[model samples]
Target: MPKLTIVAFDGTKFELDVASGSTVMENAVKNSVPGVEAECGGACACATCHVYIDDSWSEKVGAPDVMEEDMLDFAYEQKPTSRLSCQVKMTDDLDGLVVHVPERQA
Candidate 1:
C-alpha cells in the first residue's frame, strides 16, 4: 500500500493508506476526503476529481496523457500541475504522493 497525503482547500490535511493499483480518486471517495467529487466514478468523464500534484512530486507523477489533458480543461483553477485524480493510479513509487484539492470542482 502507498500513503497519499491530500490537502484540502481550507487547509485540512488527510493521510490515507491507499492500496496499490487503485486510483487516487477511488481512495479519496472511499475515505470521504472532502473536495474530490469523482462524479463519473473514475471513468475520466468529468473533472470533479481534479487535484494539483505537489511541486516536489510533480516529475515523479509525470504529465497527464492526451485524454486526461483534455478532461482537465474543464477543471476549476486549472494549473500546470492539475490532474484528474481518476487517472492517477497508485503504486509503491507514489507512497508519499501529495495532492491539493481545489475549493471547488468543475
Candidate 2:
C-alpha cells in the first residue's frame, strides 16, 4: 500500500493508505474528502476531480497525458502542477503522494 495525502481547500488533510493501481479521485470520493467533486467518476470526462500535485512529489507523479492536460484547462485555479486525480494511478514508485483540492470545480 501507498500513502496518499489529500489536502482540502479549507486545509483539512485526509491521509489514506491506498492500494497500488487505485486512483487519487477514487480514494477521495470513497473517504468523503471535501472539494474533490469527482463528477465524472474517474472517467476523465470532466475536470471536477482536479487537484494540484505537491511540489515534492510532482517529479515522481510525472506530468499528465495529453487528454488529461486538455481537460485540466477547465479546472479552477489551474497551475503548473494541475492534474486530474482520476488519471493519476497509484504505484509503488509513488508511495507518498500529496495533492491539494482546489476551492471549486470547473
Candidate 3:
C-alpha cells in the first residue's frame, strides 16, 4: 500500500493508506475525504472529482490524457497540475502522493 494525501479547499488533509490498484477517486470517496464528490463514480464522465496534483509530485503523477483534459475544462479553478482523481490510479511509485481539491467542483 501507498500513502495518499488529499487536501481539501479549506486546507484539511485526509491521509489514506491506499491499495495500489485502486483509483484516487475510489479511495477519496471510500474514506469520505472532503471535496472529492466523485459524482460520476470514477467513470471520467464528469469533473466533480477534480484535483490539483502537488507540484512536487506532478512529474511522477504525469499529465492527464486527452479525455481528462477535455473534462477539466469544466472544473473550477483549473491549474497546471489539474487532474481528474478518478483517472489517477494508485501505485507504489506514487507513495506519498498529494493532491489539492478546489474550492468547488465543476
Q: Residue by residue across 1-106, what tens digits does model 2's lDDT show?
A: 9999999999999999999999999999999999889888999999999999999998888999999988998999999999999999999888889999999999
Better of 1 and 2 by lDDT: 1
Clashes of 2: 0
After superposition of all CA atoms, the RMSD between model 3 and the true structure is 0.7
Residue 52 miss distance in model 1 (angstroms)? 0.3
Query: How many residue pairs collide in each prediction?
Result: 0, 0, 0
TM-score of 2: 0.97
What is the Cα-based lDDT of residue 27 in candidate 1? 87
lDDT (10s digit) by residue, model 3, range 1-106: 9999999889998999999999999999998888899988999999999999999999999999999999999999999999999999999999999999889898
Q: For each candidate, C-alpha RMSD in Å?
A: 0.7, 0.7, 0.7
Off by more than 4 A, model 2? none
In candidate 1, position 73 carries an lDDT of 94
